[model samples]
Target: MSNYKFILSGGGTGGHIYPAIAIANELKHRFPDAEFLFVGAEDRMEMEKVPQAGYKIEGLWISGIQRKLTLKNLMFPFKLISSIWKAKKIIKSFKPDVAIGTGGYASGPLLKAAAGKGISCVLQEQNSFPGITNKWLAKEVRKIFVAYDNLERFFPADKIEKTGNPVRQDLLEIADKKEAGIKFFNLDENRKTLFVMGGSLGARRINQLVEKELNFFKENNVQLIWQCGKLYYEEYKKYESDLVKVNAFINDMKLAYAAADIIISRAGAISVSELAIVGKPTIFIPSPNVSEDHQTKNAMAVVNKDAAVLLRENELDEKFENEFLTLWNSEEKREMLGSNFKKLALPNATKDIVDAIEKLLKKAA
Candidate 1:
C-alpha cells in the first residue's frame, strides 16, 4: 500500500473540493505512505485550495458549458480536448490504483481517462441532483458514492452507495465545545445566537435579508454571528458591534456551529450535511442560481422530514420574520427540529466513503 498512488479530482466550489480533500485525507491516514495527486481546473479555486491542504496537484484547462450561449462556450471543445489529453498523461504517468471524483468539471476528464486505462474509478455526488460530470461518468465508474438516496434515478442502481457527503472532521465534536464556541465568537451565552451564512462567495439576497432584519434581531435581544462571505464583507462590516459580529469568513466553523442556537443559511448539499450534524434549528434560504434548482431540492429533503425550515429566496421577505420568530420563541419546536435533524446525520460519512474505495481496491487486488 505504501507504493500505491491515488488521484482525486473536484473543484469550482468548496462543496465539491472539500469532499475530495476529505476522502484524500482519509486515504492518506489509512495508507500512510500512499502517494496522492489532485487534478483540478487550472484557474479554479481548487488550484490554490488543494495545495493549501498540503497535496500536490495538477491543473487542466477545463470549464463547464454555459446554459446560455457565450464566447467561453465556443472555447469548450478545445478545453475539453486539452483536458482529456492532459488527464491521460497524468493517469499514465502516476498509475493510480484508483481514481476518485467528487463531481466538478475537472473530474470528468480525469476519471474518464483513468477508466479508459483500466483503472478503477469512484465518484462522490454531493447533491440530491447529480451534476452533469458525475452523471456522465456514472456508467463507467466502479462505484458511485452519494449523500442522498434515490440517486439510482440518475446512475446505475447497482453501482450506487448511499454514503453521505464528507464534512470537516472537526465539526463532529461541536457538541462538546459550546463554552469555547461562545468565547471564540465573543458572544453572550445568555442570549440566543443566530448564525447567518451564505457560501464562500456570499449570497446577495441573504445578505440583504440580514441587513433588513438587523433591527428585528436587536429588538429580540438575539446575538448575530454573520458570515457575509468575502465578496460582500466590506458592505456588511459596518453592522458589526458587540451583539453583532460580522465576518468575511468563519475559519473556526466548528466553534461557530457550537455557538449557534439557530442558523440562517443557504442550503447547499455540504451545508445541509454539516447542519444535520450540528443539530440546531435552521432556516434554509436556498440559492436559486444553482443548476436545476438543486439547492431548493436539497433544502426540501430536510423540510419534508420536518427537520428544518425552508424559506425560498423569493419568499424570504414575505415569510422570514414569521418563520424566525416562531422558531426562536418556541423551545419545543427548536428542540424537535434539532433532534430530527441530528437523526439525519451520518457521522461516519468520510469513513464510509473511504471504506467503499478500499473495497474496490481489494477487489482489484
Candidate 2:
C-alpha cells in the first residue's frame, strides 16, 4: 500500500487556483486518506479560495516584482528569500510525498523549497506562453504538465506532459443544457442564448463593452446569461431585463456553458480549455491586464486554428456586435468553430496528471 501526501501550490487568480484544486481533488479521489496542503501568496484570492475548496492553505509573504521601478520591487529579494525559508519550513513539517505547482508567484518559492528537499514536484503551466514563474520553476521540478503544446522551449523535454487543463468534473459532461441550464437561469430556450463571462473577478473593459452593447443584444433577438463579475454587477444589473440574466457571480458554470449557443469570455487558458471542451463557438476578449500579455497569446493559440474568435479588448466596443451577429446567424460557422475547438479538448487531463504524479512518487519511493 502506498501513502500519498501532497503540498499543492498556486494562486493569485482563479486560473492558477482552480487548477491546483482540481489536481488536489483528483489526488484525493484516488488516495482518499492522502494529506494535502496548499501554499499561496499571503493576501491573494487563493488564501480565501483554497480553504473554501476544503483544504488547509498556508500563506507566504510574497508578491511579484512590479514591472515599473517602485519601493515594492526593492522588497522582492527579501520577500523571495523569506518565502523560500518559510516554504522550506512548511515542507519539512508537512513531509509531503509530492509538491505540485499550478503556476503562480507563490508557487515559485513553494515548489523551489520542495524540490530543494529532493521531493517529487510537478508544475502545471496553463498558457501556451509559459509564465515566468513556471518557466523558472521548470528547471527544478521533476515533471511539467502543460495544457498547450510545444512547451519544451520552457521546460525539460523529458519532463513535459501535455495534459490538458483539468476542468471541473461537472463541466466535463453537460447534461440537458437547454432544460437544466436555461431553467437554472430562468432563461428562454426559444431564443439564441449568449453566455458572457469575464472570468471570476471580472474584466472591466469587457463588462463595459457589454454594457455599451446590451441594447444590440435585445435588438437582435438574443437572450443573454451575463456574468458581469462582482465588481461590475451593481453598475450593470440595472440594465438587466427579460432578455438578460445578469449576476455578480455565477456558481453554476456547467449550466452556463450548457445553455449557451455562443460565448463571450476572457481568453484565460482555463476558460479557453473549458470552451474547447464544451465545443462552443466563442469570442475571446483577452484582457491586457495579465502578465506577459499571455491572454492574447492564449486567444491566438485557438483563434489562429479557427477554434474561436479573437476580439482584442481595445477593439471590442467596435467589433463585438458585428462579430456576435456574424457568429450567431451562421449556424455552419458555429459548428465549424465548435468542431475545431472540441478537437483541442483533452478530457483526460486530470487522470493523466495524477498518473504522472503517481509514477514520479512510485519511482521516488
Candidate 3:
C-alpha cells in the first residue's frame, strides 16, 4: 500500500482539538506509514495541543466573528482571506489524499480549500446542533460523521453517518481499573466518590458550587475528586484534603472516571460523549456562554432520555442541592441513570469514523 498523506484541522478549544487528535491517532494506527499534518488557527489551543500529541501542525491566521461588534470584527474578513490563501498553499504543497475537519475557525478555510482542490473531505460534528463552520462545509465535504441522531436536519441525509465523538481509548476499560483508581487518588473505597469536571480550563460556576457544598459532602460521607481547572486552581487548591482531591487537570482521566461513582460536569459535546461511555450517574451544568446555546442542547439529548440530569448555571443556586441529594440518596436511581447512559456509548466511534474515511479514499483510488 502507498503511504497516504492526510490533513486534519480543528482548534480553539479542547472539544474540537481532542476529536481531531483522536481521529488522527486512529488513522495513524491503521496506516502506520501515513504522513499527517494538522492545520489550526494561529495562537489557538490546537497549535499547542497537536504538537503535544506528536503530530506536525501549521497555524493559519484565523478566528471566529465575535458576537459583539468590536475591532476584532473588522479584522474577520482579513483573517478569512489570509487563512484560505494559506490553506490553499498547504493543500497544494502537501498533496493530501484526504482532509478531515472536526470543526473550528481554521477548519472552515482548510476543508474549503481541500475540497476546492478535489481532495475528498470528511467532517465530524460533535454536537447535535451543528456549528456554522460544519454546516457551511456540509455541501462540499464527502461525508459528515456525527455524534447525535437526526442531524439530517442540518446536513444532507445521504451524507450523514451517526458516529459518536471520539474519546480517549483508556476510558473504555475503566470498569477494570476501579481498585487502581481508588488507590491512585488515595480515597476511601467505602465512601461514594463524586467527580467534578468543568472542561480543560474549568467552569467557574461549577467550581463555586463544589466550594459551597464541601461541608455538605463531608457530612454525608462522600469523597470528592475535583478537577478545578487551571484558572481556578490557586483559589481552590487550599481545599484539597483527604476527603477531597483537587487537581488543575487530571492527566489520567481513565483513573478519574474509574474512581467516580457520580459526576458533575459541563455539557460540552466531547465531555458528554466521554461521560456516556463512563456510564456514571452524571449531572450536567451546561455553560450558557456558548454558540447557539449548544451546550444546553447537548445536555438535553441525554436528559430527555432519562440518562443524565441537566442543571443550568442559572438554576444551580436554586436546584443543585435538591437535585444532587435526590441522586446521592438513592442507589437505584444512580444505577438506572448509569445503565441508560452506557447504552448511548459509541465505544468504536473512532474506528467507525476511520472506516468511513477509508471508503472515501477507496472510491477516490
- RMSD for all candidates, in order, please: 1.1, 1.4, 1.0
Tens-digit lDDT string for candidate 2 (264-314): 998888888888889989998888887889999999989888899998877
lDDT of 1 by residue, 158-192 (tens): 99888899988788888889899899989998998
Residue-level lDDT tens digits of model 3 in 47-93: 88999999999999989999999999999999999999999999999
Off by over 4 Å in 2: none
The C-alpha local distance difference test score for the whole of candidate 1 amounts to 0.92
Ranking by TM-score: 3, 1, 2
Candidate 2 lDDT (Cα, 0 to 1): 0.88
| Candidate 1 residue runs with Cα over 4 Å from true position | none
The global Cα lDDT (0 to 1) of model 3 is 0.93
Per-model TM-score on C-alpha atoms: 0.98, 0.96, 0.98
| Candidate no. 2 TM-score | 0.96
Predictions in order: lDDT: 0.92, 0.88, 0.93
